[model samples]
Target: MTNPLKKYGDARKERIDQLAAMSDGSVAVADAGTIEEAPGVSLIASAWRRLRRNPVFLTGLTITTLFIFLAVFARVIAPHDPAIGYLLDKVRPQSNPIPGPEPGFPLGADNVGRDFFSRLIVGSQQTLIVGVFATLFGLTGGLILGILAGATSGWVDSLVMRAVDVMLSIPSLLLALSISALAPRPSQWTLIIAIATVQVPVFARLLRGTMLQQRSSDHVLAARALGIKRSSIVFRHMVPNALGPVIVQATIVLATSIIDAAALSFLGLGNPDDRQPEWGQMLGQAQQFIYDDPHLAFYPAACIIIVALGFTLMGESLREALDPKSRR
Candidate 1:
């Protein structure tokens, strides 16, 4: 018969070996309770699972993806020069202001006699640039204001919020138009900056609200107790965790950015260069010939509407997916 003490010692050694095999100790924590259980699905991972199953999100993703592909491949895919009226002979006489679809030109001719199809294809690049850059600039501005207010709190938060409120009080479109009108001359950059300025208040307000919640979270409390620097607690801990809602808001803001950029261009505050085609500028130029050729105005208008719709749908679906209350 084996000694009882030796049997107990053997069992204990077996358990230790099993634990050593299972865990490499690669995942570190300041304390054992800091990570009591094994890692599970993260917030972003869980939200993505929901979003993939959402039809609204998929539809928007398809539309947005196709739009981006077109913009990126404009030069490669466009059959004709967007700036050149290469098929002037194909266009009907001055008796007809714009021509309908033909053999090579599917969308026919624009007001200036350029191939409307090529212009539409190429104009996507310009529209994409405006939407992305304006949103990025606005997001950067918002992040700055939000971080300052959310981390500092007290008087800083109040002052920042009040300023944001002042901006919000004015009509958003009107605010954008006022800024665009300030430029010495109309250009794509000017339009982007104007739209970005208008968007800053919305993003700042949303991020600040989210960040404020993170300030009192349990993890933050733990970090403080660990004697981490206040800056590290704010930037390293609080800021990263608080970005989920802000990311969701950015998607919605992208849709608005596109529409606002178009509106600015439509108002003759967009790029003045005829060499570079843009949907909004195309639509603006076509408005004069609406009765003579409604299709010209129709095409660009439809593109803007559809693109904006896609972003809105994606943003809404993503918001629902990320909402803690709706988690599956």
Candidate 2:
């Protein structure tokens, strides 16, 4: 019988010969083994690529993108006339047909005969505006106050922290309500201030804590030892490092701000003269139709709920994406 060792050596020699022939017989490889591929891109790039792999994230992103587009182009995208009132059609339920010869309204008409679909489209503008402004205001105020408190740890920190503590102790909604009630009718700016006020304490606390933790890190210490200006360390170095959490928090706060703004608007403080086509105003108007035509209220309520949910889901997805600890 043929020796097993001789057979193994022949197989190995054949493989080497095949490789040498492939390389034009110019070079010979004594031993060849499987080679592993090089490592992929950076963590962020890898994370992003992996994120695209997730169907849930993609679906959420698509929904959010569509909603944003709708909000941005409400006037163009709306099927019916948002402001035009159909004298013939009023209090039409969502499930009912349109107002015509066998007319069918996909979304139906409100108590005022306004197209529910159109109004809903316009309402997106209000939510986006409120969410964006409230977040900006909160982020701005938080950054300013947090930086001040964190950089200075003496009486300044104590004062700022105590103020934040006091604000935090109060119920955010209650505080907003009190301010809304006490203030004269609110303009857009007024509403922004009210929402920002509620959000500031939360952001301030978050940023302050983050700053405190980063203040003593090696990079910060090294910068200090290198004679880097304190301002440079705080703004350029520390703030950037601490921003991951801030971004996640901002997304969440944006969603909360939208909901809060809607609540306040529902209470009559939303639009100055109730002329604006805001979701909250629609909600307020919806209340009047509760006993009569429930559809008027339902349409707006559904829009608010849906938009709020979309924002919440987007925010949560953003958090998961940005937070390393949450990554698999």
Candidate 3:
């Protein structure tokens, strides 16, 4: 009461002393605006960080990488030429003796005595090529149609959407089957085109919806206000932003493409040359000997399953990374 200023000074000093007593590591102090915020990480980097922590993503990445490696180095990795069959082993009747894994042929011999391991390694190339190219063709066509529809209003949007709807009305495999059947020489190229055709409507619809949403976003509005050309805004701004979903979808579609290629091959629409050593063709050949040598079907089927699982896991993980809402 007698000296109020003295009491206030003592209280301030006590607080200061308390803070000073705290260890530097224990007490973190920063000016309001001067505190350093974390550096901005790019979306890809952030996604990668998150993916690294995920088991599903890791498994998928590993399998996919292994398959890609096999596809690229098929010749180098394969122990024997896929085309050369064991003529002596070919003489063994399916009923008398069914081959199992042995020296040189770790995965055993197929119905025609081809080295199962060698054919499998070589077959990866064909599967990957078909999946990749078919997806590319479909994606390109879809992007064009979707961008056109999304950038323009009125009749263009209606026409494009309607066409996509019509295509979607039919089953994808059935449509692909019909297309492949109609081709004059349903080779690998024809199969690719058929699978790609089925994929077009899927990508078109996805991009169209994505573009419609992005068309009115803040950045797009800003670009329009800045007198940016419509084409530039559409192609440069909207399309780029909308590609996240497309990329995820493309991964999933690739798995489907591989499966479809296999299916077409299984149905006798794949490569006519037996020497090509495709997984589906192998399965087709193994059908008759399923009872005697089920291992023949198991190998290719397992490969297909593993490859599809890899793509699926990767796609789902990517979807979770890209969309915050899905994280929950």
Model 3 misplaced regions, further than 4 Å = 1-17, 21-35, 88-90, 93-101
What lDDT score is found at residue 251 in candidate 2?
A: 70
lDDT of each: 0.88, 0.77, 0.86
Estimated TM-score per prediction? 0.86, 0.80, 0.90
Scanning candidate 2 in windows of ten residues, the lowest lDDT window is 95-104
Model 1, span 227-305: residue lDDT tens: 9999999989889988888888889999999999888888899999968988888888888888878888898999999
Which candidate do you rate higher for lDDT, 1 or 3? 1
**Which 10-residue span in candidate 1 carries the lowest summed lDDT?**
26-35
Please give the distance, in angstroms, between residue 202's alpha carbon in candidate 2 and its true position after superposition: 1.5
Q: Per-residue CA lDDT of candidate 2, range 96-186, in tens?
A: 3334222545656665566777778888887788778888988899888888998889999999999999999999888887777777767
Candidate of highest TM-score: 3
Task: List pairs with backbone clashes in candidate 3.
Answer: none
lDDT of 3 at 14: 83
Lowest-sum lDDT 10-residue window in model 3: 24-33
Maximum-lDDT candidate: 1
In model 1, what is the error at residue 64, expressed in angstroms?
0.7
**Candidate 2 clashing pairs?**
97-104, 97-105, 98-103, 98-104, 98-105
lDDT of 3 by residue, 1-328 (tens): 5699999999987887777567564544433236557999998898888989999989998999999998999989999889887734544673545466788878777656678889988998888888999999999988888888888899989999999999999999899999989988768899899999999988988898899999889999999999999989988999999988998999999999999999998998877787877888788888988876788888898999899899989999999988878872
RMSD of each: 8.1, 5.6, 3.0
